[model samples]
Target: MSSASTVAKKKQTPQNTLSLHYLGDRVLRQPTKRISKINQSVRDLAQEMVQTMYAEQGIGLAAPQVGVNKQMLVIDCDPNNTATPPLVLINPEIQTYSPELATGEEGCLSIPGVYLDVVRPEAVQVKFRDESGRPQKMKASGLLARVIQHELDHLHGVLFVDRVRNDLVLTEALNKQGFSAKAVQPIKS
Candidate 1:
């Protein structure tokens, strides 16, 4: 088989389906935890998360949003998004964050087209583990940092909708144009 075919087979599987998709009602509302022994099952779940995130045109997705409620999450911000490494984070944690902040349009698969202007740190340093149970650390900025922060929030029972920084009514208008449910609250003197 060709190298492409071989690689495809490695990433192709049924567990690659979304565990909880589209504003998953009450199930997604529950909190997630950090547990021991994620194993292959967790790996499968992460795979499914990548597929689901791409399918939904999302930059990131979380385990709790899918009903797993773990510290696991995924990031595919390779710009081109080849999905290599696939960014399968287990028992993930953010070790450091930058002081600078920025506001950009944000949305989620669960909340659909609803989006809003949300402010986040301009950069961050995150620490997490790989599917193989190996520890890893990442420092990111720009769009990549934004995506990481978004997924990390999912693990902490936070949503982009809750992080909006602009007027809610204006956000509703933006959502009609395919935005998230909330906007970042602006800083005032």
Candidate 2:
């Protein structure tokens, strides 16, 4: 797998790149399949995903957001910092979550222009395969942890809006963004 640093961290709006699937798109709701084999194709996808994320000015992106049904995601919380490398996770599994929760504003590439406060574990321990297919375990917190959890949700056909607690705010936000509230499949706690 090529190093993520090889891709330019600076945001660019490239034409003909992967198009993001919107909230109401069926592709965003479809569950992704675990990658059985990681190869050049997978690495290529990861690279492109990173590019697409940068193009969209997003901090994280899941394969489902680009109409791909694969358990893969790319994240770069600090896109402007060339020193920081982007992350590519394949078949990520969260092993544990911190009992303490934090509430923060969350947004999705699939659900454009709708940001809402959502509560999630402040920290998480996760296992996944890197771009090179090597097993990796990581403990993430703060924005990185939030981004990981949000992207992981996409792999399971779940969006952050589903985790939102206040129906009125969610409805208002969705409506303001021109997305129908009916499209959201709320997750009952």
Candidate 3:
């Protein structure tokens, strides 16, 4: 690599480049103790997660998606999916789920704008590590379910689009059902 490239890579914070959303360069983060104090470590991961999420124009992102194959993730539900209290799920595990199912338009930072109608539990109970590495569980419904399910799917190496439709025409019909992707171009190959 060139000297400038090396400097740029070194200068990259956890957020990464505002232009590179795939976070492909990031690697797996180590798991922390449930009771261990993870203020600095959590903060670093959170900052990087948000930076990567915003750079991709996504509402939420998981650590594994960016190559940090940990149980962590971040979510923002704004048009940019950038919310004030970004949901940080470290070592997150879905504990419960509603019997009700919902199909929502979903996409991925890793996969770009290709979208489809995917079915998921409309409500979910998730147990995960907090920013401090403490374990916590919460029941989520509505958009929260959608977000959590999307990230959790990543943990299993599943893409939201994969669960949804691959047929563009079917995808269009699903979008009419309120599954809108508003795709952005993938930054990495």
- C-alpha lDDT values of all predictions: 0.66, 0.88, 0.59
lDDT of 1 at 169: 62
lDDT head-to-head 1 vs 3, winner: 1
**Residue-by-residue lDDT tens digits, candidate 1, 51-165:** 7666655667788766776888776655253444456677767778898999888877667657667788999887777777777777889887898888887776666766655
**TM-scores across all candidates?**
0.77, 0.93, 0.66
Q: Arrange candidates, best TM-score first.
A: 2, 1, 3
**Candidate 3: C-alpha lDDT:** 0.59
Q: Which candidate gets the maximum TM-score versus the true structure?
A: 2
- Go through the candidates in order and give the clash count of each: 14, 0, 7
Deviation of model 1 at 172, angstroms: 2.4
**Residue-wise lDDT of candidate 2 within 1-189, one digit each (tens)?**
224433334445564268899988998888999999988888888888888998888999999999899999899999888778888889999999999999999999888899999999999998998877778888999999999999999999999999999999999999998999999999998
Clashing pairs in 3: 14-48, 59-81, 71-91, 76-81, 78-81, 96-125, 105-179
Better of 1 and 2 by lDDT: 2
Candidate 2: where is the Cα deviation over 4 Å? 1-13
Error of 1 at 2 (Å): 28
- Check candidate 2 and list the clashing pairs: none
Query: Which candidate ranks first by lDDT, i.e. highest?
Result: 2
